[model samples]
Target: MRAVHHLRGAAAAAALTLLAVSGCAEKDGGGGSGAIQVTASDSACKVSRTEFPAGHVKLAVENKGSKVTEVYIYAPGDRIVTERENIGPGTKADITAEVKAGSYEIACKPGMKGDGIRQKVTATGQGSAKPQDPRLDRSVAEYRKYVQAQADETLPKAEKFAAAVKAGDIEGAKKTYAVSRVGWERTEPVAESFGDIDPKVDVREDGLEQGQTWTGWHRLEKALWTDKKIGAAEKKLADQLITDLKDWQKRVGTAEINATSMANGAKELLDEVATGKVTGEEERYSHTDLVDFHANVEGAHKSYELLRPVAAERDPALAAELDKQFKALFTLLDKYREKGSPDGFAAYDTVGKDDRKELSDAVNALAEPLSKLAAAVAS
Candidate 1:
């Protein structure tokens, strides 16, 4: 049951003031094809080049590990410049990110846990900060506003869920549980940027670090559904959940967001769905995986749509492919909806193997094209 998704989280960092969208192209300095080669094995992380010119950089990553792995480009203070997750064994990806002149680490998290193996590198020379396109500016602003709105809507729903738990109403808490999570799931990339908040509010039991207390939504979820009772401890945790989420609500305004991050974040949502929801690891007890699945798709689609104008302008073919894949995935997901269900989707546990396979296939289809989004917008 300890899938690759159980261990994903990010720390907080200041907003990157530099404006540059990502697109794969020829290397700025003297390098072949302009992509830094990254090889991630079980024991080591290797980068072909130690440094590159600031502006747009590409890391062509290959996972040689036996287990799934994720790669992150962290600025000096662990601020994520850009990252690619759920790179399964023997797979490869070309990740494009915007970087300024500074030191950074290319980290490989094999098995998707812990501090990750790091490779130090520097962004030499000046960064490309001039506005590439006015459309991208609009894209960033609109995405930020959308993230804020999701946060604004989440607080009230989470409060209601907390209240229901405190009042010792199992059925009431269950009803509100998936509803409260929709907003958070939709904008997890933003929410996860705050280092201390994500684990506090959303960490799964298996994802917990040693000595870390399990106190988020999943903890309470187990109590409500599996344990089937809310005692004093559960009530206290309910209050703690609200406090932690409110911290996330307050910090949403400060998250590091950019055109590249938005594009990367959209891809991250698909990773979340593939690793966690599609596998039935998330929302395990309540079987609300589909609810989370829907939200993840919605969030990813929001990012894609906002960046569509620019993406389409840069690469029309990729844009059309993305539209088709997104529609196909959404259409498949729509088949699972149920009017009688609390979350408007059939229980995940009841989903047949054939159906789950179909869902996973559709997600993979969308993710493959979606992965190229950063490079498309970069142009």
Candidate 2:
């Protein structure tokens, strides 16, 4: 029994290592030359073939520009599968995905934001690969791991920041808060995509930049950071931040739907925007939506921090390990916050498409660390 368990563990580790090397894994079907050619350009995305036989189809994506790009495959029922990472300009990578007979959209985006070039694809004839089960898919698992990492890595430090503020240690609060921002920024790419979703319905869209109104928490950031006064208003602002942070932490743990719902919601909104069904002005209500999304994630982080004390009580050794991972995540978020300027909108505007792509890449970078933390915490 022990020997069998050891072998199984080794096989799982080997499989994971293979996944890391290939970036994507082959799902089904024997080897063949049946591959779809995909090309990325500065202004558009193109695919040599739109239709393919239903089965395990390999997509060879070639990036022909000066910037890195991401190719996303969206199938029926809003299923998104990604083959992403740094694909340097003038380079190429091949992704093998199990595709079934259905309508699909292949999108290539320079950055994760703005408009991406999309080509529609359809599959006909019989195929071996079956329709993907949404609940148990790898993408969903990846997303969950990402979210949990954000929570575990950043939340506690944010709570410490809040505690410092409450104790009138403003400088300490700022320094501690800086640590939490790193993890937050690490996850920003995935978070920003949430902006493309419907503003009113999705909680993630609370801090968008293109909207007419501004009601999200970042409105407070503008007030606190931009304002000259360091008086009562600052204190009030700090208090509000603390309050919101606490509330967010409480809600995120119990929330049933999770971040995946927000991602699906954003994809739907993006599709609507693409079809000319949803105008930008109508879709982007304000920068508040973006702020709200950040707040939501930050709240989750706070909840994760609160678990630290409990974790320590249960297992001090494990808690120490978790603290290190959390610290790294916090450092990343703080660095991201510092990289941007005081004028938030201007900072966002000044970022080029390539820079945005880097931001998205950074988001993907958090997956492994996050997955490790999530597995450790699993009951």
Q: What would you estimate as the lDDT of candidate 2?
A: 0.42
TM-score each candidate. 0.88, 0.40
Query: Model 1: per-residue lDDT, tens digit, 76-145?
Result: 6665555666778987766656677878788999997778999999889997675668788888889888
Residues 27-97 of candidate 2 have per-residue lDDT tens digits of 33212356687788777788889887876666777788777776766544333433344556787766654
Off by over 4 Å in 2: 1-32, 53-55, 65-70, 74-89, 98-103, 110-113, 122-157, 160-172, 182-209, 212-379
Off by over 4 Å in 1: 1-10, 15-33, 63-68, 76-81, 86-91, 109-115
Candidate 2 weakest ten by summed lDDT: 1-10
> What's the count of clashing pairs in each model shown?
6, 23
Q: Every model's Cα RMSD, please?
A: 3.5, 14.7
Instruction: Give candidate 2's root-mean-square deviation (CA, Å).
Output: 14.7
